[model samples]
Target: MPALQTINVSKSYGNFKALDKVSIEVGKQSIFGLLGPNGAGKTTLLRIINMISVMDEGKVLLNGKPVKQSDIRNIGYLPEERGLYKKMKVGEQAIYLARLKGLGKQEAIKGLKEWFEKFDITSWWNKKVEELSKGMQQKIQFIATVLHQPDLLIFDEPFSGFDPINVNLLKDEILKLREKGATIIFSTHNMASVEELCDHIALIDNSKTILSGEINEVKQRFKDNVFEVSYRSLSPLSLPAGHFEQVETQQQNGVFVSKIRLLNGNKPNDLLQQL
Candidate 1:
């Protein structure tokens, strides 16, 4: 059974539909990508899952059962907008949030220290939230979110405010969480990250899903039958076949590299034999 499932879920504000009969299943230990342009209902769906908003139509299931109000304890959420008490010390705020998520005082402190140490922000514990940089605040937020080790995690634009190195660090942590039996629903506009981290994805457009499937399958479905090749050449020359549609070609360090999108019955091996 899927760890989380939404069946024909819909949400609206007045006459404007925010989500239109959306259905999706997030498997256990899987990284599912919820992708879309702005105002495509990704946030609406996430809000419904987080219980921040009510769904006007359809049901959401957790572990094959109707989602219970109390079941939210099994989930952790990090919204696109960061929310932390500016005046509160990082450690204090983290402990408070963890307790709110049902962690005991000792457990919260232990987890917070471990996470802060792992992120190399141990010295920032006594500092006020405002004193920390945006990325540091993000790390604190992430630590608080996962300290309880919920079975399902929802991260909306998690890479925001992070540098490339920190972005990669968070990605590694996300993968580690998945490996340790957590299911993650990642909502992001970063298509490159989607290509790298998603096992399954649902693309939303205009409050509806435009595409949904396994990542590899979806990429294959969108493939243009293209191939890229590099070869040594005695002289600079181009292939003279109408069937061989060369999208791009370049010569670098005396080697010819070209990208070709096949049109008719043309094959890369045929082109290679000719070469």
Candidate 2:
């Protein structure tokens, strides 16, 4: 069964339609990427799933059942906009958020301690949120989000403030979460991250899902029959006419590199046979 499903969900604000029959299914224990341009209703859809906003039409299902208020306990959400209280100490704030998700005081503390140590932020426990850099604060927020070990995690622009090393750390943790049997809905504008982390993807444009599928299948669907061949050859390379159109050719380190487009439904093997 799917971990979560939004069935033709729609949301509107006055004359503005933020989501128009937006629908997506997230597989269990997998990372799903929610991608779109600014103002494309990606956040609106996530809000509906989190019950922060109501949908005008359609329903949300978790584990093949209709979502209930109690189902919120099964989800951990990190919004695009940070929500840490600047005046509150990092550990104090994280524990409070964990409590809100139904973790007891002791359990919350224990969990937060482990996460903080993992992120190398144990020293920031007593420090006020305002004292940390944006990247540091982001780490604290991430720790709080996963402290309860919810079955489903929703992260919107989770890597926004991190440097390269921190970004990779977050990526590793996200993959680890999936391995630990958590389903993740990862929303970001970064296509590179999507390529690296997502098992499935849905692209929303203008409040509608314009594309969606398993990552590799989606990539194959949009392929343009372009191929690049690199080989070592002493003589100038030649190809059969009509099998391919050579777009470019170059020689580097005594190797010929060529980019070609298949013609008339010809396969790469056909081109190779000619060469």
Candidate 3:
């Protein structure tokens, strides 16, 4: 059974309909991406799943059973907006959040120490949250989110404040979580990260799921049959107009690279023969 499933989830706030019949299935221990442009209701769908907001029409299931309030214990959510108390010490706040997620005092402390040490932020323990940079605070938020070790995790724009090095660090950790049998719902606008981390994805636009599937299948479905060719040509290149349409051409390092799209049922072999 899928670790989580949302069926025809719809939600509205006043006159604005935030979601419309959005449905998705996340396999067990898989990294599922919730993708969409801003105002596309991706966050709304996530909120519904996390039970921070209720859906007007739809069902949320965990392991094929209807979700309940108690099931909140099974999820860890890191919102796009950071919410640490600015005046609270980093370690204290993290412990509080972890305890809220059902971790015991000692467990939270041990987990926080391990995570802080791993992230190289052990010295920031007693510092107020406001003393840290955005990226530093982001790391703290991430540790608190996962310290409870919930089976399912929802991270909204988890890489927002990190530098490239930290980005890869967190990416590696996320992959490690999946390897350890946790299902993750990752929401982000970074297509590169989606390609690297997500096993399946759903694209929401204007309050509806416009596309969804395994990543490679979605790529194949939208492929335009364009091919890039790189050759060392002595004379000006020529192609039969009916067989191929040249989209772009550029010279790099003594090689001519051109992007060509097959036309009128012509194949690459047909283009090769013409060349």
Q: Which lDDT value does model 3 have at 112?
A: 92
* Number of residue pairs clashing in candidate 2, backbone atoms closer than 3 angstroms, sequence gap of 3 or more or interchain: 0
Clashing residue pairs in candidate 1 (N, C-alpha, C atoms within 3 angstroms): none
Q: Can you write out model 3's per-residue Cα lDDT over 34-103, one digit (the tens) per residue?
A: 8888889999988898899999999999999998998899899999876789999999999999999888
lDDT of 3: 0.90
How do all models score by TM-score?
0.90, 0.89, 0.92
Q: What are the lDDT scores of the predictions, listed in order?
A: 0.88, 0.90, 0.90
Residue-wise lDDT of candidate 1 within 1-275, one digit each (tens)?
99999999999899999999999989888999999998899989998998889999999999999887787789999998777999998889999999999889999999888998898889998999999888888888888878899999999988888899998999899889989999999998777865699999999989988898999999989988788888888775466677777788899888988887776777767777666
Better of 1 and 2 by lDDT: 2
Put down candidate 2 lDDT per residue, 227-275, tens digits, no spaces: 8888898865677668788888999888988888999999878887877
Using TM-score, give the best candidate's number.
3
- In model 3, the runs with Cα more than 4 Å from the true position are 230-236, 249-257, 264-275
Model 1's C-alpha root-mean-square deviation from the true structure amounts to 2.5
Ranking by TM-score: 3, 1, 2
Which ten residues in a row are the worst by lDDT in model 2?
Answer: 235-244
Error of 1 at 34 (Å): 0.9
Global lDDT of model 2: 0.90
Q: Which is better, 2 or 3, measured by TM-score?
A: 3
Q: What is the C-alpha RMSD of each candidate to the true structure, in Å?
A: 2.5, 2.8, 2.1
